[model samples]
Target: MTSADVTRPSPGRETPATAAWRPSRVVTVPPAVPPVTTGTLADLVLDWEREDPGAVCFSRRDATGAWRTAGVAEFAARAREVAAGLVAAGVRPGDRVGLVSRTRYEWTVVDAACWFAGAVSVPVYDTSSPEQVAWVLSDSGAVVCVVETAAHAAVLEDVRAQVPALRHSWVIDDGGLDELVAAGRGVGEDALRAARAGSGPGTTATIVYTSGSTGRPKGCVLTHGNFVDLAANAHAVMPDMLDEPGASTLLFIPLAHVLARFVEVLCLSVRIPLAFAPDSRELVADLQSFRPSFVLAVPRVFQKVHAAAGHKAASGGRVRAALFARAEATAVAYSRALDAGGPGARLRAQHAVFDRLVYGKLRATLGGRLTRAVSGGASLGEHLGHFFRGVGLTVFEGWGLTETAAPACVTRPGDLRIGTVGLPLPGTEVGLAEDGEVLVRGIGVFREYLNRPEETAAAFRDGWFRTGDLGSLDEVGNLSITGRAKEIVVTAAGKNVAPAPLEDRLRTHPLISQAVVVGDERPYVACLLTLDEQALAAWGQLHGRPGLDLATAAGDAAVQAELQRAVDSANTSVSRAESIRRFRVLGQDLSLENGCLTPSLKVRRSEVLRVFAADLEALYR
Candidate 1:
């Protein structure tokens, strides 16, 4: 496609102009729900309690591994009690209360409680280090902190001196929530009502810090309206997924992340039963036990599921592996045929056989009732997208950042497209700059960065917020992210290369965990790779070499050949100039512990380049 061709969507399939919009450069979707002019996030719980006291909104696992359910009335009463506790403890209106916890029942209650008390909540990731904890607390000026564990409380103690505003801390594992409830026994009902009524839709709700893939994490100031309006609009557009009877979800992603945080409110707004899996080690068990109808996760999680299935099949022996491979290929073909009209009779038969033999088991792994999933944070790529849909789980890819209050655009259920991240949400407009940078303006868009007026001003151009990510809109207005403009690598020969597509493709392979494509000023494209330890162990055992370590496997002939095939497959998608010419497999994997990956799992590209400089230089030599 020529430059002009790539700039515009297909000839006649343009989306209706809702703004003074251009064909591909800009597109807008009219709001399906009316703008939220009144009410705070606190009211979502309170209104439910008043109207549907017996409605089941949350399900949680107890210490004995039993699942327990909570109704709207119980949840509302608990939130009120927690809010009263905060008030009794001197947490005044608009005060910042820090919450450091994993995804759990109490985390949601605390989030609601903060809003009930008319306070702004600051969520800190449980995995965050002491320094990160210090920065967020000190910067946000949190007056009180509620941590999930004694270890986290200890981390807070280390930073207590730095954050002079933080006067007290509570540890939930030690019955801190119970203590809070007890302390608030004498608090008046009128005080709780007044606190809940103090804030309107425009009042600040939370200060969510960016995952910081590049620089220091900045606090994104999201308002009550951003969550309330966005959730209402999202529900309006996707009622089949959100408003259906028995619609439920299992949230394993960290609640500190903006996407999961928004999902917390989205589920509450729609009155869907939401469950949390705080420990990843227990995620599979949780999925099976909770049996959610729909779920949400990043693309990496989907990729891991697919890879694990493949590895499991391989472990069962060659014949089983071949049958599974054929089943996977048939699934991809069947899904593609669906887009081309419908599957043929023979393809249908093949899919039916596989659904009975292989697909059913895979679906059972995620809970037999899981018919749909929502993917964000990164691209799912067309390969995994089709395979999962083919296997009976439709994964909807969404696109957004912390500044957008989660989703600016998300694929709809019936109108789904495999490769693209669907149209802008209702009340949202998306545009591409001349350089292909994505710009967004919507109900979900955040107000500003905390205490960074100049940076906030620079983040917006005119009225649309500059997303800094390159993307293109398709014929049907589905948005496909190309790459981050900042991460683009220009070769020594002056050819521009977008590494994300290639890296995403490489990660689809079972043995690869992370792929960092580097060649900014080098002769040609090259890559620094890290292996998936779990997949590596499984792959090694299947290859007659048990007890394999990353360092030894980096030079293993079989490993090199397998990775080479994966690389060669990725190279087929790009021009010879942009293709990866060489790659180095590191002895160690990049991780959050080493500061190479953000909490959201995006690679710190500059960090990778710095830490692996010698590897890149060796690739050229």
Candidate 2:
């Protein structure tokens, strides 16, 4: 974790792009930190205990809603005890164990314990249904499963007969971990060391299932070297953020996600004190209490925060609302100025005034300490990125998928590219296929999709792994994702269109929650829209239509006019043939509960097209 560890590009290595006009097709960054050759992930815990025994490594909320800290020595001791329990229970090296839970301190302990015991940890989402649990457990052949509650256990019980390999299940809420610790008292330290020594950097560390936004979830085989090497390289490339004085982060994203899981190991490697928000409902309250210096979240979370601030200002009366609007414009302008030299004196003065009024309050809402964040899972709108930076919070947007073990490319705070996903990390190579498909090759990429040899072979061509995403690299190697190749729409006239740009622009409007543009095999492009409940309510109250229901609002002329204006603005970004021609507003928002969105907040386009087939047909009619 020092500047000396970073490796610059070798002499004569061609830069990815350099033309003053068009972008390039390939980008490669040399390894910032050398790949780990011998040690396993378990060695990270052992090193922490031996070197920084008393350093705080994690924090958790107590029963009374207060923050509590745990040091490296204690964390390691707990993990060793749990590892002994697994060894005593007939678990051996390479055995698969299931972990089903929300983001919490215990999840990390169990994860480390699994590594220490030379077992492969399989993470199942806490919100998974019985069928999903069965599919993952059966597919991975997990022998032991740990669940957070009785409800989660019940779901497992419903499909226990289907998973013949499962031998035991434990409930965290009922003190299952304590019982295991008590049962392992007789196991000697020699056995624990032997178990840990069985694994190396090449050994399998975990099998994480995909979010299944399109089809059945697949188990991805991630080796210990993937985490170890990627963590070192990521830290080396972004030392400014990861090595900042008193740097710490609160992780609210599900542990089952590759991004959050990677951050878990990165925090431990860099000795950054990490905290978790088990329940998203209490995230705001927890932020106030924990006061973390940084955070990791998806783009939707930022959108909600901005929407909430706008709603709050509108509630404070018309004059306050107008002032807030002016302040917001000043902030965006101020941030844009930073890219073009610096802000003018008058603009800087205006920003200074807003810092005392609007900006400070916005920062305080996310815990007064938050100065940096890492956004992924989807493209964060350019305006939101600039707005946050203007208000004193800098968000670094990154891009990657489950196959790449989290981020392969990330924006650097020092260079500050507002629109693009950013440069490839050290040791990562990004290129485009002839058809514009994104290809990746790096230490972070997964070895294979578990138990799918045919599929695994198909996933890689020559050397790079196909990402199924389309993107472009700028003149300086910054990557900007355009859309998903499989999700592209084609009209009857054979004109191709990417729906992502239109959808992203529409979602930026306060009244719009989700948008799906459709025109495949049809005469023209059309769209299906869902209104944001919170924003709609505020808009209704301001227009003398308080307590308006969604059905009534859908037909209201004023609401229709506002949405049309938004649609018109979005259309300006593309050609007339690609622009949305007609639209139908849905009666409700597309959400995870409604089966229109996935656990990672990505829209299930196929599901949307199926459920709203009639609405789409009406647009053409």
Colliding pairs, model 1: none
Residue 165, candidate 2: alpha-carbon lDDT = 98
- What's each prediction's clash count? 0, 0
Candidate 1: stretches off by over 4 Å: 1-24
- The TM-score, computed over Cα atoms with residue i paired to residue i, of candidate 1 is 0.95
Predicted structure 2, TM vs. truth: 0.95
Q: Give the TM-scores of the predictions, in the order they appear.
A: 0.95, 0.95
Candidate 2 residue runs with Cα over 4 Å from true position: 1-24
lDDT of 2 at 146: 88
Give the C-alpha miss distance for residue 1 in model 1, angstroms.
26
lDDT of candidates 1 onward, in order: 0.88, 0.87
Scored by lDDT, the top model is 1
